[model samples]
Target chain A: DVKVTQSSRYLVKRTGEKVFLECVQDMDHENMFWYRQDPGLGLRLIYFSYDVKMKEKGDIPEGYSVSREKKERFSLILESASTNQTSMYLCASWTSIRDEQFFGPGTRLTVL
Target chain B: SQQGEEDPQALSIQEGENATMNCSYKTSINNLQWYRQNSGRGLVHLILIRSNEREKHSGRLRVTLDTSKKSSSLLITASRAADTASYFCATEIGSARQLTFGSGTQLTVLP
Candidate 1:
């Protein structure tokens, strides 16, 4: 089974604070993605990495960044957490040969 | 802008009933996929239907794709309370290798 694990299930941060959400996939997939889910907006990608050291911006990359130093781990960085930035963050990984994306159990961040 | 949009943002049904959700996308796609998510958890891949394929089935889940209309539908047969969850449709474009997801349909199955 493919397993994707996120560093936190819930997080609380003050405005202007930097936040880091970590994700690791055991399947060794080549592609890793970070997305945020809002009530009515659904899940929108913030950033994605096709391979280690290679990253691409997704639809909503503002106020967020990603790092993939190794193939199995991908991290999402919030430069400055704001109240509007509070939401459920999800991480996913997929292999080059397959289209299925396995997702980690999300991280719910609350900016206070 | 979101590439796909699912209809009937919310659906409620009784146990043992059939539930269907529709998804429409704005562009040509290599394939369309359906995923299920329980509240506050990760999304689970349900099924995938290629552009060329009109219909596909997995256990109680059935998916249909129409390349001409750029639309797809997922039907869950004999739904149970355990089937209550949010369903999303994802579209894969050429070479992007990334899936674009719609907001999702919230399903409620009552016993």
Candidate 2:
């Protein structure tokens, strides 16, 4: 069984504050992704990393950044948090040969 | 920016009834996948159907992919109250390994 764990389950931050969301996967998957889910928008990709220190911008990557310091860890960073940045963030990892993805329990961030 | 579109944005069915959901994509895909998410939780993998395959089943969930039509369908038989969740269909383009997801269908299985 694959396990993806997020650093925080729920977080609240004031406007203009810096925030970081961490994710780690037990499985040695080669691909990792970050997404923000909204009510009507479904899941919008924020960023993704296929290898260490490598990253690509997804559909909605303007207000966020990501870091892949290690194969098992991926971190999402908000340069300066705003109220509109509040969302449920999810991290997922998948192997090169497999089509299935393992997702971590999401982090619900509330930017006040 | 959405690649896949799911029909019937919402569905309501009684327990033990079968529920079917449809998804259509714009571009050619290597594979199609179905995922389920309970309220306020992370998405879980359900099934995956490759381009060459038409239909596949896992437990009570049946998935069919029609490459010619660029569409797919998922059927859940004998749904239970625990089946009340949002179902989404995703498409993986040639070698990207990234999935483009559609707006999910909200399913409510009344018990």
Candidate 3:
């Protein structure tokens, strides 16, 4: 079974504070993704990495960044957390771009 | 990821009945995929259908794609209470690596 683990299930952060959400996948997948799920916005891609040190901006890359120093772990970083950025953050991994993505449980972040 | 739209934002049905949801995209896609997410949880991939293919099935789930119309539908037959979840349709365009997802259809299968 493919297992994806997130650093936190729920987190609270103050405005202007930096936040780091970590994801680790047991499967050696080549592609890792970060998405934020909102009520009506669906799952908007924040960033994705296809290989180590390789990253691409997705539809909503603003106010956030990502790092993938290794194949199994990916991280989403908020430079300065804001209230508007509060949402459910998810991390996923896939062996290939065309393959199914396995996701972590998700981290619900609240920015005050 | 090509931004796709799913209709009937919410659906309610009894167990043993079928639940159908539709999706439409604006751009050419290499494939269309469906995923299910339980409340407050991450998504699980349900199925995928290539643009060239018209239909596919897996277990109790059936998927149909119409490339000409840039649309797709997912039908969950004989659904059980455990099948209650939100269903999302996502489209992946050729040469693109990310998936653009629809808001999703909230499915509630009652006992």
lDDT scores of the candidates, listed in order: 0.95, 0.94, 0.93
lDDT of 1 by residue, A12-109 (tens): 99999999999999998999999999987889999999999999999999999888899999999999999999999999999987779999999999
The candidate maximizing DockQ is 1
lDDT of 2: 0.94
Candidate 3 regions exceeding 4 Å error are: none
Instruction: Give the DockQ (2 decimals) of all models.
Output: 0.87, 0.83, 0.73
Superior by TM-score: candidate 1 or candidate 3? 1
Clashes of each: 0, 0, 0
Q: Write the per-residue lDDT of candidate 2 for residues B1-111, one digit (tens) a residue.
A: 788889889999999999999999999999999999999889999999999999999999999999999999999999999999999999999878899999999999999
Candidates in descending DockQ order = 1, 2, 3
**In angstroms, how far off is B16's CA in candidate 2?**
0.8
Could you tell which candidate, 2 or 3, scores higher by TM-score? 2
Model 2, A74: alpha-carbon shift in Å?
0.3
Where does candidate 1 stray beyond 4 Å? none
